[model samples]
Target: MIELQMYINGEWKESSNHEKRPIVNPANGEVIAYAPEGTIKDAREAIDVARKTFDEGIWSDLPAVERASYLFKIAGKIEENQEELTRLETLDNGKTLREAGYDILDAAACFRYYAGLITKPDGQTYHVADPMQAMVVREPIGVCGLIVPWNYPLLMSVWKIAPALAAGNTIVFKPSEITPVTPKKLFEIMDEVGIPKGVANMVFGAGPVVGHEIAASSKVDMVSFTGGTKTGKHIMKMAADTMKKVSLELGGKSPNIIFADSDLETSVDYALFGIYSGAGQVCSAGSRILVEESVYDEFVNQFVERANEIKVGPGNDPDSEMGPLVSQQHLEKVLKYIEIGQQEGAKIAAGGNRIVSNGLETGYFVEPTVFVDVQQDMRIVQEEIFGPVVVIQKFKDEEEAIKLANDTDYGLAGAVFTNDGAKALRVIKKLRAGITWINAYHPTYNEAPWGGYKQSGIGRSLGTFGLEEFQEIKQININLQVEPIGWFANKNE
Candidate 1:
């Protein structure tokens, strides 16, 4: 267990109120850290620091290449401390060390990728009404409010921060109350690297208090939020009061379509790992596994077997493949969903009971659950559980598969597994999702754009798309180069 201090105004300080929340390890239900509990007052101070830093034009005025260099430094430092970060994440949030460890690497990669992108330093240059006088520029959108979730805390933090920083926007970030240690460590690392004061400030508080403050803040130019869809809607409404630009990566009810002709082995492997991995807490979890009717039973049998085979325990244990949920509330929520599945007449193929009752002392651990014969409109199939639970439904043809796959308010991510190129491409084209995997799942990269079409999200988060979200484009008019192409605004042409 670690005691973490708040990082604000380029230094570590105790909150004015000096309140602290005990972050418990879900794997063992033990206190892992005493994290600061910040108030709305602290959130305002953090925003002030960010706004002042942006107005000062220290980082924003810097050359893109130089900004990129700083990103590299951060990445290098993260790589150097990967082991410590992995352990911290596992202890703080109840994820396996291996998954959290790789997340650190991915976080470093995101920063490095965004860093390289900012060096381009150009926006628009093309034929205009006045071709010779045409101009283009980019301006930073001042202070950003980054509200991150407990799952994948560090990686998600970097996802919000790196690109915003690369685009020259200072940030007042709020980490979820459950997992506050990683962000503190990240802030400490940034301070060690000499990132300017107010460039990055953090407040530790929950959704209603701290999260709402960031969303409703007039000082913040933009809000980048990742969380449940309902909360995201609340955030959108809150930010709307001030007309702040917002990028929301919300919940998903994504599908995984496995054709009968596909390579069943590889497809099932990624299919199982996709939803079951991370204890099925991923936003992109292929929760709805839509298989061809021919191989549906076989696939379910294998999937259920594989799912039941997983060994669950404390995240610190190297042998533990799955750990506990983040808290008791979440555990109960997942179990309630299991009850919903049974009530909806969906068949539970394997384990559906709680698993932590044995040797586990205090963590929130539940058995991996798989459901079959699920109706398309069942509540369990419709809502996101955010746990190690998956719903399996069958489709007779490609049309049915595509139909079932597209039947959701959330269009975040989906997958189509088939060896036939035509079938795969057909399904890929038909599946209306943000990121559709041809034969894989959860394979997002820093270079590829990641966003949703409908309720899944607002703007892209990674690749060039993520970096540009914080940049406001401006057209520069310079008559020094040439004359106007057409007399639209000026008679001088």
Candidate 2:
């Protein structure tokens, strides 16, 4: 099995405690690799290194063009190793190779986007009423702690890393312990690109240990995390001790509102793609689908028909349309949610059991599931199952559709599928979400701002806003004329 080491302070080192955790391939329950299990001390050492690096200005003092050059080279290296990275991602995270390939491409694009963006003029000069000049300048926020989720390991890491590095912030990264393979490869690429020592470091371990240190340490100037809402809240509390900046991209139970006027076949296809992609482990998965009363029955029937056709198999299999869940523990969680859906009196309209046949029994596989007659208050509809399960609810009119979509505490993402452009626009305007799509489901762009309105997240990621998250804005004022007015009466006067 492949053995991985933690990248800390420019050194590839094992955990100080010499502990290792088996990295399992969820596809077949095989140990694919072993990763260093970092301890609190390892985490502290990385943080200290990052703090010193930021203080010394080894990277933060570099010119923007020089920083952009590093980002460009990192992007190039990622492109050069695309194929191997894709395979490693699939093996580590149990996603289809095609999906992993898309993530790899996007990660490269993210780095390139930030590289170009950083070279552009960012600060603003303002005209003042007095004879003084005023301007705002952006500077790095010292050391940053970046924590990413397991579902989109490399892509999520890039989402935080690209912008943070572009803004010239030193960082201590912590990837989910369950999926450390691709992240290790990413660190290798960064090292090969010759990033300055301590400018970027990574620790591998459980969240309560490594992640906690990153969040709680005073040396960390900011923490950006993408994970469950509950965990995001805990990070916020921990970061509060140091009064550090925090950006979160958290959980979602987003709605996909389908009106009768929508293209039926296309809507059905996107609906399936919306929930079943990544086996519904996506943070912004359309788990709650709201359909107009006129077409509720038709949409439900067509959606179930398509969900049943999705080929559930291993990520490496060429014919597999949908891969297994990320891990056996996650599989059990998904299964339990399915049972909860039934217990809450929602009708199971499609596959809901674990798939165990055709040599797939060893894998953590679950058939794509659908639920009907689901009420808004039911646990199945309100909570994020984070699996290949979706609930369909009927709406009487446009007003009801808006009400149903806004009912959730999560405001991460939502979509409206309809033929009438005006109606689609009108409904989307009312959605209490950060990311909204008209006639589309899951097409995210690096140029667009991403996050939520409410509990879905705090602040945003991607686009220009993403870079600002790692920066501190400062105002500078200068007197054009040297002479100062004697406002205060002097003793001689």
Candidate 3:
């Protein structure tokens, strides 16, 4: 097995305590690699170096365009090593190689997109009446702490890192301990691109030790995290002590509404794509399917037929449609939920068991599952399974659909499928989510704002909004003409 070291202060080294953890490939339960088990001290070292790098202005004080150049170089390196990176990501995360390829390309595009954006110099100038002028300038918030989740590991890391770096901030990033291979490879490319020493660093460890240290540290200026809602809330409370800036992209149980007027084939295909594409591991998975009562039976039939056709196996296999869960613990969690769904009276229309056949006995594989006759309040529908499972329900009308879709704590993402233009707009407006789709699902872009409402998350993470998350705005007001008028006379008078 390959052993990986933590990247800190322009050096690849072991943790302060010299501890290590194994990285398992979920596909076959193989210990493919090992990473440093970083401690609070290691996290502190990363934060301190990042703090010093920002204070020294080695990177943050450079011209915006100059910073963009470094990002461009990083993007180029991703494309050049796409094949190797893709393999590593799939081996680490157990996502299909094709899906990993898409993530790698998207990651590269994100850096390139930020490269172009930083060139614009996101600042504004205004001319007030007469002799007064005002300028609004955006400057980097120093020593940012970025914590990303295990799913889509590299893509999510770049989503946070690209914008933060483009805005001229130094970073101390912590990828999830479950999947650290690709992020390590990414730092290799960052090193090759000659990123200034201490400008960017990576730590490997659990959230309680390394993660909380970064969030609570006084030296860190901001914390951007993408993970579970409970964890996000804990980070928020921790950061409250220092009053550090925070941006979170948290969990979701997004709704996918299908009206009777929608195209059945297209809607069915999109519904499957939204939930099972990543084995339903996505935070924004449309796990709740609310179909119009008139066509509920027909849609469920089609959805189940398609769900059974999905081939689950190792991610390295080019023909496998879905791969294993990230770990055995997660597999058990999903199986328990399936048992709970049965007890709650939700019918298992498709699959409800683990896949241990077809030479896949060792891997943590789960068959694509679909639950029907599911009520809105059922645990399977209300909670995020984060597995290859989905629940289907029937809605009577537009008002009921909207009400059902909004009847959850999460308001991250939702989808509406209907041919009626006016109805699509009207329903989309009523759905309580940051990202809504019409006749489609799970297609996010680089130029649009991506985030959620309510308990879903606190702030946006992509496009111009993402860059602003790592920045602080300053308003500069000046009087062109020298003025002597004052409310109070001089102290001498």
Candidate 4:
């Protein structure tokens, strides 16, 4: 078994209390690793060191070009360990190795993309009233606190870390308690890239302790979190004590609307890819599918057939299309949602039970579930199951579809499938979501802006918006005239 340690101040260290937790493989409930259960004192030390590093200007004061070079090197390090990291992620997070490979590639791309953009001059100069000029410049926001989720693990960590480092800020990060193995690998790469002491620190423990302390740290200038809505809200409340900048990317019960005019075969394929990808653990999975009344029956039949064909088993299996959930707790949660769906009178059109066969009896496996005749108000449709479960509801027209899609409290992501380009565009405009796709689902890029409206999240990540999240804006005013008109007692010089 691998032994994991927290990376802080450029060193791998055990918790002060020597507390540790076993890292279990959800595929077979094996103890694959043991990670430090860092405490509040450990979290404070990481934050303090990051604060000192930022204040010392070791990282935050570097020239943009110099910082970009470091980021480029870090990206290269990630690329070199791509294969190893992919397997480790599959072993730790229970995602298919194929999916893990895609995420690592994207993580590398994110670092490179941010590295290329960080050097470009930010802020603008404007000519104002006579003999005066105004300039708005962006600067790093000092120390940052980053909390990553268990679902995407390393990818989410990279999403926060790349931009923060590229923007010239030091950070103290906290990985999810359940899946800390891949993050340890990430710190190993960060060390290989020679990131300075305290510039990038991490702690592994429970959210209420390590995560909360990071958010509540006065030394941290900003907090960026990716997780559930409840935790995001609590982070907001805690960060408010210090008035720190907060950027959150939270949960989603996204809607995937399919019209009758859409390509039938293509729509069915996208729907399956939408929810079943990542075992439906993706935050932006289109869990609530709304199909037109004319083609509801046909679409449901083919979609069920496709879901049934999915090979669910250990992630390492080359033929396995869907892997086990991340843990036994999460598996139980998904199974409970399936029961709730049936209790609400929704018909199960596809698999909806625990998979206990083919040497998978001990694994946390739930078959991909599809529900039909689901009402918009049903808990199964409204709540985020975050599993391989999907709910299909019929819509009479575009108007009803829009209403149903916008019904949820979440406005993170949604997709529309139709042949008419104009109709697709129209539907896209009406959908109350931050990210919308015409015929595709869950295709996110490092070059584009991502986040959500309403409860789904606050602020945006990726693209220029993501870089700006770790930045603080300052406006500078210059007076060309040697003498200034006196507006107050000491106005004239």
Best-fitting candidate, scored by lDDT: 2
> What local lDDT does model 1 show for residue 6?
78
lDDT of each: 0.87, 0.94, 0.94, 0.92
Better of 1 and 3 by TM-score: 3
> Measured by TM-score, how close is model 1 to the native structure?
0.96
Model 1 clashing residue pairs (backbone):
28-363, 29-363, 135-476, 136-476
Error of 3 at 132 (Å): 1.8
Model 1 C-alpha lDDT per residue in residues 1-493, reported as the tens digit of each score = 6868877888787777888888888877778778778888888889888888889898899888888888999999999999999999998888998789889999999888988888875667767664356657877889999999988889999999999999888999988898888888888889988898878888888789888999999999999999999999999999999999999999999999999988899988998789877889889998999999999989988888888888888888999888888888898999999998999899999778887466875778888889987899999888889999999898999888888888888899999888899888888888778888888989889998888878898998998788878988887776654644554777554
Error of 2 at 88 (Å): 0.4
**Candidate 3 local accuracy as lDDT?**
0.94
**All candidates in order of lDDT, best leading:** 2, 3, 4, 1
Cα-based TM-score, every candidate: 0.96, 0.99, 0.99, 0.98
Candidate 2 on 149-268: residue-level lDDT in tens?
999999999999999999999999999999999999999999998999999999999999999999999999999999999999999999999999999999999999999999989888
lDDT of 1 at 298: 91
Q: Tens digits of per-residue lDDT for model 4 on 1-493? A: 9979999999999998998899999899999998988999999999999999999999988888888898898889889999998999999999998999999999999999999999887889997867888999999999999999999889999999999999989999999999998889989988987888889999999999999899998898999999899899999999999999999999899999999999999999999999998999999999999999999999999999989999998888878899999999999999999999899899999999999989999999999999998887899988889999999999999999999999988999999999999989999999889999999998999989999988999999999999999999999988888695766787354
